[model samples]
Target: MEDLLRPIYQERASDRDTLGILLIEKTRPNSPLTDDFDVILLIIVEDNEDQPWHVKHYEFDDKTAALHVVTEELLMQWIDTSSYRRAVEWVIYGKVIFDRNEYISDLKEQLRSFPSVKRDLRKAIEFGKLVKSYSEAKDLYETLHFKDAYSRMINSLHYLARLAVIEKGFHPEVTVWQQVRYIDPEVYKLYEELTESNEDIEKRVQLMILAIDFVISTRARYSAKHLLDTMGEREGSWSYSELKTHPYLLSYGLDLTAIVSYLAEKNIIKTERVETKGVGVYQRKYLVTDKE
Candidate 1:
C-alpha cells in the first residue's frame, strides 16, 4: 500500500501549502462503502485565502485513487457542523502518512474531545433543517404533489437521524440509519414508518408528518437553544435580516424566519414590531424572554 501511495504523497508534497496527508485503504473487497476506490487520500492544506479545496482522481498500474484537497479552515467547519461525515470518519480511521508539526494528530484529538457547545450548536442546526424539510413536505402534500412530498419526507428523516445522533453527543457517521437504529430506536421507527409501512401512500405520508410535528413541538426548544442564545447575545432584539446574515448561523443554511416563527408559536421567544422611517413602515424583531 505504501509503495502505491508514496508517489501520490510525493506529488502533493510539492505544493508549498500542503500541511498534512491521510491515507485510507479499502479493506473489504467489492464493498460499495469504499465508493469503488482502492485508496482515499485527504490532503490538508493551510488557508491560503483561495478556494477551499479541490478533487483529483488517478488511475495507474491498475490502482485507483481519489485525492481530496481540503483547507484546514474548511475541515474544522465540517467537524463543527457535522456536514462532512465521511471526512470525519476518514480522520478517525485513516493513517497519517505525513504531518507538518502534528497538525493532523491535533485535529483528530479535537474531534475526539467533542466539545459540548459545538455538539449543541450542531444539533440545533440539524433540528432546524428537520423542521424546515418537514414543513416543506407538508406543503407539498397539501398541494397534491405526493411524490415530491415523499422525497421531502425522506430528506426530513435524514436530518432527524443526524439530530438524534448529535443529541447523544456523537458525530453522525456516513451510515446514519445504522447509527440511529442502535442509538435511538424511537427515531429509527419514524424512518421505518415512512419507508416500510403497509399503509396507503397518503396515509403513510400523513402519519410521518404527524410524527415529525410531535418531534418538532417537543424537541424544537431544547434542540434550538443555541440559536436562541445567539439571539440573546445582544440586549436589544434582532431583526429578521440581522439573524439571517449571522456568520455562525449562515454555515447551517437555516431558514431563520421559519425558526423564529416556530419559536414564537411555542412562546419560547417573542417578536416585536419596530417602526421604520417611512409611514406605516415596520419590521419584525425577535428576542428570547426571561420566561423562556
Candidate 2:
C-alpha cells in the first residue's frame, strides 16, 4: 500500500503542513458513496490560518484516486459530531502512509474511543433538527401548502431516521434510510406509508405528520436532554439567543425557539418573561421545570 501511495505523496512533496495520509481501499463492489473510485486518499493537515488546503482528484489508467484535504481541527469536529462517519471509519480502518510524530495513530485511538459526551451531544443536536423539520412540515400543511408540505415532510422523515439511528448509539451514514430500516423499523414503516401508500397525497402526508407528532411527544425530551441540561446549568433562565449561540448546540443547526416552545407545551420546561434594558420590553426565558 505504501509503495502504491508513495508516488502520490512525492508528487505533492512541496505541499507543507501535511500531518499524515490515509489510504482507504474499496472493499465492496458498486459502493454507493465512492462513485466507483478504486481508492480514497485523505490528507490530514495542520490548521493553517493563512491558507486553507485545496482538494484535488486524479485518475490513472483504470484506477481512480479522490483526494480530500482536511484540517486536523475540522477532522476532530467531524469525529465528535459523527457528521462524517464514513471518513472517520476510513481513518480507523485505512492504512496510514505516513505520520508526523505519530499524530495519526493518536487520532485513530481517539476515534476508537468514541467518547460518550460527543455521542450525547450529537444525538441531542440531531433530535433538535428532526423536531424542527417536523414542525415546518406541520405548519406548511396547515397553511394549505400541500406540495411544499409533502417535500418538507419527506425531509423531516430523513432527519427522523437519522435521529433514530443516533439514539441507538450508531453514527448515521449517507445511506441513512438503509441503516434506519434495520435500526428502527417503525420509522422505516412510516416512510413506506408516506411513499408507498395508495392514499391521496394529502392523506398520506397527514398520516406521516401524525406519526412524527407522536414521536416528538414520546422522544423529544429524552433525546434533547443534553440541551435541557445545558439550559439548567444556571439558576437564571436561558434566553433563546443564549441557547442558540451555545458552543455545543450551534453545530446541530437547531431551531432553539421551536424546541423551547415544544418543550414548554409538553411541560418539560417553562417559559418566563424578563424585562430587558435595550432589546425589548420583555424577553422570553426558558427554564427547566421539576418535570424535566
Candidate 3:
C-alpha cells in the first residue's frame, strides 16, 4: 500500500499546511470502504482554499485509489454530526501513513472517548429521525396503507438502532445492526421481529407500533438532552421558531416539531402561553423545566 501511495506521500510531505495523510485499504472483497476502490488516501489539511473537501480518482499500479482531500475542520464536523459513518470508521481504523504532531492519532483518541456533548447531539439527531418516521408510519397504518407504513417502520427501527449504539458510547458504524445487537439486544430484537417475522407485514407492523411507542416514551427525554440543554442556556422561554433556528442546533439537522412536541407532551419541558395578535389565540413558548 505504501509503495502504491509513495508518490502522494512524498508530494505533500514537505507542505507545512498538510497536517496528516492516512491510508485505508478495502477491508473485504466487495468493501464499499473505498467506494469499491482498492484503497483511499485521506489527506487532512489545515485549509483547502475555502473548499471543505475535494475528491479525485487515480490509477496506481493497475489498481484504483480514491483520494479525498478534506480540511480538518470539515472532517471534525463530519465526526461530530455523524454525517459520514464511513468517515468515522476511517478515522478509527485507517492506517497512519504520515502525521504531523499526531493530528489523526489525537482525533482517534477523542472519538474513542465519545464526549458527552457529541453523544447528546448525535442522540438528538438520531432520535429526531426515529420520532418523525414512527409518527408517519402510525399515520399511514391508520389510513390502511400497510406497505408504506411498513417501510416507514423500517426507517424508524434504523434510527432506533443508531440511538442505541450512540447511547452505548460508540458511533453507529456502516453496519449498524452489528453494533446494536451487543449494545442493546432488545432494540435489535425489535429489528429482527419487524424484518424477519414469518407473519404477514401488516401483522408485524401492528405489533411494532405498540412496541415502538413504549420505546419512544422511555427514550424521549434522554434522547432530547441536546435540545433541552440548549433551551436552558438562557433565562426566558424559547418559541418554536427560536428553538428551531438556534445556532447551537444549526448542525444537528433535527426535526424540531416532533422533538419539542414529544418533550412538551411528556412534561419534560413546560409550556408558556403568550397572547397572540388575534383575540382568541395564543402562541406557545417552551421553557426548560426541572430535568430530574
Q: Against the true structure, what is each candidate's TM-score? A: 0.90, 0.84, 0.96
| Tens digit per residue, CA lDDT, model 3, 97-207 | 889998888988999999998999999999888989999999999999999999999999999999999998988898899988899999999999999999998899999
- Candidate 3 lDDT at 9 equals 68
| Maximum-TM-score candidate | 3
lDDT of 3 at 87: 83
Task: Order the numbered candidates by TM-score, best leading.
Answer: 3, 1, 2
- Model 2 regions more than 4 Å off: 1-4, 10-19, 26-32, 82-86, 99-113, 276-281
Q: Using lDDT as the measure, what is the rank order of every candidate, best first? A: 3, 1, 2
Q: Taking the tens digit of each residue's C-alpha lDDT, what string does model 1 give over 1-292?
A: 6787788788777777888898887888864435678888899998656579788898878878888889988988888876776788888888998888888899888777778889878877887788788889999999988889999999999998998888887788878899999999999999998899998788889888888899878888788878887877878888877888888688555566677778888888888889999899888888787536
Poorly placed runs, candidate 3 (over 4 Å): none
Sliding window of 10 residues with minimal summed lDDT for model 2? 47-56
TM-score of 3: 0.96
- lDDT for each candidate structure: 0.83, 0.78, 0.89
Error (Å) of candidate 2 at residue 244 is: 2.7
Clashes of 2: 0
Error of 3 at 53 (Å): 0.5
